[model samples]
Target: MSESTPSTGASSPLHVAVGILTQGGKVFITRRFPDSHQGGKWEFPGGKIEPGEDTLSALKRELREELGIEVQDARAYMQVRHAYQDRDVLLDVWRISRYQGTPHGREGQEAKWFACVELPQLEFPEADQPILRRLWLPPLYLISDSRRFGKDGFLAPLERALKAGARLVQLREPHMPLDEFEEYARLIAGLCHRHGAHLLLNAEPESVSRCNADGVHLNGKRLTQYSSRPLDDHFWVAASCHSAEELRQAERLGADFAVLSPVAPTSSHPGAATLGWEAFSRLCATANLPVYALGGMRVQDLARAHQAGAQGLAMVSQIWGANSIERAVTALASS
Candidate 1:
């Protein structure tokens, strides 16, 4: 959840809210009835805080009243003060852990749980999209070689992962039929856009245009050819860099981000020599642009990379065909 730390000065009325993020990362939300205020809308559970009530106390009361659930742990994630047509509201979003009772609608309303990607399909209030973006972010990134997981393909699985909280994705679909690949690319782009996620396509500028994805991912050859002028404003340009020289070259070309791979060797690439964590840390610390650990990676490696100055992790295959997208997303995000 992001706080409304406005970059500029603006004053608005103060209203507060809290969201109960349940186990496996499913968020508890309530749906509004038609003809009510912002009626027929779904939003995080919690209501306005009184003049004297503390954030936690107000959240507990709101949960108990709205959903009939007892909140155990309620801590603030951020404070968002926004102005509405009628009044100002200061929203304090909190992740609720344990509750005493099952959540049921009190005022002829309904409550349900959903993974991040699936949330957009629901009738949530427009104001809640920012929180959904935070829910889509993962801690680590796994730079992948296409079809590493036996040719069922990456799109379906990655969609599941993205639902689970994967904020960033890289489309390095090599060796696949370009015509067929465009279909997959379009599917992934739609998913990312719905969930507020980032996507980078490896060079294949044609794919970026046809699929209308987030941006381009440049390989060693493409990185060297860039001259600072980008083809599109919507597409972010990232490069693959293996050394300091390569990193500098990528930065000079205005690459949005760079993937520094071989951070570790794994079953995916048995013949490749891996760069141990120390060297990976050194390379990341010295780089000017944001860096992601590319080689064989897991959800757990995000903390290690973060400490070493990396932005986040990327992955393929880990997110596909999963039954519990929420669990997988929480694992990646918390890890």
Candidate 2:
């Protein structure tokens, strides 16, 4: 097996509970008991759902029992399945932003609040992930990402995309020179916002000050290393995540959204293997952020992404691959 490659194996069946405590853009977490399963790890405070109990009702009841707080208005986030040597299981997760009462652990668990942007430092359990992603970003935006922009590029195409109703735009020019790239980014960011779309930078924080972007996009590298709090308040942040661990971290970082890649391997990475639908759903089921599947993805994958609990799809080639922006937007919107 190649290093960094994920193992493909059958999943185990286990029920789990998790909570997302959001206060002033921060989430509260619990340090697991040293004697418990995955002990000493940090996680959202929740537990298994009873056979007849609904997931939300179970979460609500668990929170009140474990933390001494009453939860209200809970929504489904994502579901996750993990296989371990000793045990394998599925976790149904949810997010509750409305709650009452001061929470303290009545169950003898140590609890603390960390700003969402700083969650990497905490030891979070894997099951609480998908819930994190949904809370961190804006609804996912699928857009075109072509490499041919120059003097004759950008304004015309972006305008067309906006007019065709493409809302989320990522100005990622991996091959372009810094100066030329910044100019195009600034140009497109303005056009997107003018059309009432959300514009995200492809991880050039320094350049964002000069552009009218709504947020920044951190590639997996930046997603693993950087914390987002120091950025200007006007700017929101997003990240690219490829795994359950990455998705969890994205949420902890207060990202506005995350791009989850290669649900289906594309022309760009043909040699890359795809995450089969079942595992993809399992991974997505765990994150709390709105996830957009990137890499080798097509408009057809939108329904799959949504059913797996993702907010929507994010694309590059497909958005720019069609003969016209109108075709891509129409297909995406309909999906």
Candidate 3:
């Protein structure tokens, strides 16, 4: 059941520690009791945080009390703040990969495991929508470096990456001519779909529809140009954000996610400023959407990225420059 307490008429949002427990490619979920808040809806299990307690402590206590499982391995996933008519909530979500006991509804709620693909079919509270999107996204976001590899040479590595388990890709060739880029995007889109991967074109918003790509990735300049979301909900809208303001704008524009870049100095932009892990975490804490850490990111940086509150890493050189694309991709998938 949702842990939202009755409205004390307080303006501060209620803080709930939610756990997403996964095993063998499926996630465990429970149905809220019909008499509880957000009743009868499916939800990741958790409860409210008491004063003077940390998030993980509250999470561990909630799961033990509500699901009869001891959290063994877990990490902060994302935070979501949502408002309903009577109350507001701040969901402190965590991803639990290991536990000591099997999960059961100790609270008399119905509990079950479902594959990630099946989650969309269930009804959930409005706040769970962003968490669902985060779950659907892959851990590694591969950004194309067509200019460095050349158009013809790019496909082989991309295909190799896909075969090795790269489910998400961004075709970013900003300098290419519009006509040429569109044509190339069409070919790439077809290839991505054939491999069961989704592709986002880092080109103009219109080009996504024209090229039949899965979505559009807006650069910082393009992000500022849009007063509203560039595409409808059917298409993914991702923006490259460097600061909190840009992240806020992306959220306001209804972007699905964002790539926060320059987490470290990159070879391509050695002189440019970097966010570093500390600053990145600060910015991510304020963001309402999932953020992927980009710039100078490699497979090895994924853990630190997650520690800093990133959904994952978006890579260019680390992927395209790897001596073994398959090995790099496989490592990312396993990570």
Q: Which candidate has the highest TM-score of all?
A: 3
Please give each candidate's TM-score: 0.54, 0.59, 0.72
lDDT of 1 by residue, 1-335 (tens): 11233323355455666765666757777787676656778888888777788888988888788888888876565454444465456667787867788887776587777776687677655455445544544565534344645334655556666666666777676777887777767776787878767766775666787787867888888878767735543356778888989998977775657888778875567888887789988988777667877666665677788888777765544444235646766786666
Local accuracy of candidate 3 as per-residue lDDT tens digits, 1-335: 44545555566788999999887778899998888888899999998999899999999999999999899889887787777777888889999978898899997899999998789799999888778767888789999988877899888999999999898899888788999989999999998999888899988889888898988999999999999889865678899999999999999887889999889999988799999999999999888788999989988999998988888999999888899999999998766
TM-score leaderboard ranking: 3, 2, 1
lDDT of each: 0.68, 0.69, 0.88
Each prediction's Cα RMSD? Answer: 9.6, 12.8, 5.2
Candidate 2: list runs displaced more than 4 Å.
Answer: 1-140, 143-146, 149-151, 228-233
Per-candidate clashes come to: 13, 30, 0
Measured on C-alpha atoms, candidate 3 has an lDDT of 0.88
After aligning candidate 3 to the native by TM-score, how far in Å is the CA of 207 from where it should be? 2.4
